[model samples]
Target: MRSVNYARPTPALAIHDLRKSYGDLHALKGVTFGLNRGERLAFLGPNGAGKTTLIRCLAGLTSADHGEIFLAGQPFKSSEARQQIGFVPQEIALYADLTTRQNLEAFGRFHGLRRRVLRDRLAWALRWTGLEDRADDLVGAFSGGMQRRVNLACGVMHEPRILLLDEPTVGVDPQSRQRIFMMLDELSATGTSILLTTHHLDEAEERSDRIVILDQGMVVADGSLDELVEQSVGTQRLVRLRIDRPLSAPIRAGVAEHAASFGATGEEEISTRIDDVSDHLPGLIDLVRRRGYGIADVQVEAPSLHHVFLHLTGYELRD
Candidate 1:
């Protein structure tokens, strides 16, 4: 298998000036981004931020008013080009009445796989979903998580070069959500490019190689976590120290001239923002100790994806 995180000569999927509209309401406005080969990208947006619309446009489900899409360095046109992309919608698109094996068989055949290849992949899908023991069980009888796994297996049966997942773990429990990501990890290890949308910020923050945040149908932020933080939210860390008593006159004078603004929130609370913890925290501690002040506790909060998202978009990702 090709190494999962290696750089490629070109992006697996490239979208430029992708725009769509419904009457006067614009669903997408000049959206543009690229999905690097073998990289997992989080496409995030709030409700009605055009994430779903962009996905639909790329999947060829909904026509965009204007845009250019490229797959593997060529203009993305024709059914053959479409064949290189696999999309899993947020809804569980499966026949619940059908048995797990039956569903797999149907999906494989729909993908135009021959009997022998379909048969081999059927077993692989069943095993990959960890539903081999329940192969004959009806998908409707399975839990939401189980049904989701089957849904995922059906979409990827053809092993498309690019995978677009919409809310892959939306309705599932935590354990199943974890399992779903592990399954995606296996796919990524085989060098599949992934672009997934989810309401879960923590998952996006933790799982994605890069983040592209959309707001009001526009690409608002795009970069790694640290890059986003530095670009959108400054890198200063908030430090709050709870001491036993107020600072002495001498200690207050010593720290008053510092750029971090060592100020007392209360008789026992010292609050400041520091650029470097190792260089600043110990000095503050020693300064307090030398003055015979007792330390109670300390808290340091660095900027996170949550902070960057809020700063850039100015709205919590509701829905």
Candidate 2:
């Protein structure tokens, strides 16, 4: 096998103005992104939104009609580039007849590892994936989560600097999903740059350092979670209040002037959107007290990633 070097000091991955088309359908419309060493990015989009296509391009499994892809500051089509990157597909690709350890050994050898290196990788991978006890068992006998773990181990056994994962946690139980996230965190700590694509928005929100939201083969939003939420969703913050008595017309008009929109005297509570909740909340409470209304409760709602996606695309993230 080729000598795998984990100590290289290069930009983990880079893509410049990538474009791909299949007849009338444009799979990728000038998509571009770059990742530094040890960075973790989440590629998010709905079905047919070019997430898979972009992954395929990065993996060198699909050729781009236009644009350039680089790995470790070198052309991605080079053999060295292919050897320096690890790809874990959405589908579990493994030999059912082979034991988990055997599968890792086979892939390690395919990557040009010597017998001794392959043995060491096998042990490390099993331990890393929490499958050391199940090493000798055939992959066909393992549960879905166990098999998924093995699938991940296979990709990382060679210790590629850049790891590309396509929906790696799909169809797994909550426990397994959490385990996968933990393993990813470990990998990142060790300086492995990861580019993962998934529809699991909440998990992405928690784990990703940067979120890239794609729509119809275009990048609609890209930034930190808070940045995306603030940019896509309106700046106005929502505040809900429950008063002891109904409000009068003048007070309602005052609120309307200060707020973008408001509804009062509801069956449960009064909700309004204000530019600055911190400053306006006090005035609102004081007005209610002056009107002889008792304050029951108040709740403030800030913009979330879900709300950001909805506002930018006019559809839910899952849709």
Q: Tell me the TM-score of each prediction against the true structure.
A: 0.90, 0.87
Q: Which ten residues in a row have the lowest lDDT in candidate 2?
A: 1-10
lDDT of 1 by residue, 1-319 (tens): 1224436677898999988999998999999888888789999988889999999888888888998989988888747655788889999999999999999899888878878889999999998999999999999999999999999999888888899999999889999999999999888878788999987999998888889999999999988888898998889998887888775543453444542435543467777777999998898887777667788999999998888888887865545
lDDT over C-alpha atoms for residue 64 of model 1: 86
For candidate 1, list the clashing residue pairs, or say none: none
Candidate with maximal lDDT: 1
| Clash-forming residue pairs, model 2 | 1-112, 1-113, 2-112
lDDT score, candidate 1, position 213: 96
Model 2: per-residue lDDT, tens digit, 92-140?
Answer: 9989899998999988888778778888888899999999898899999
Please give the RMSD to the true structure for each candidate, in Å: 2.9, 4.9
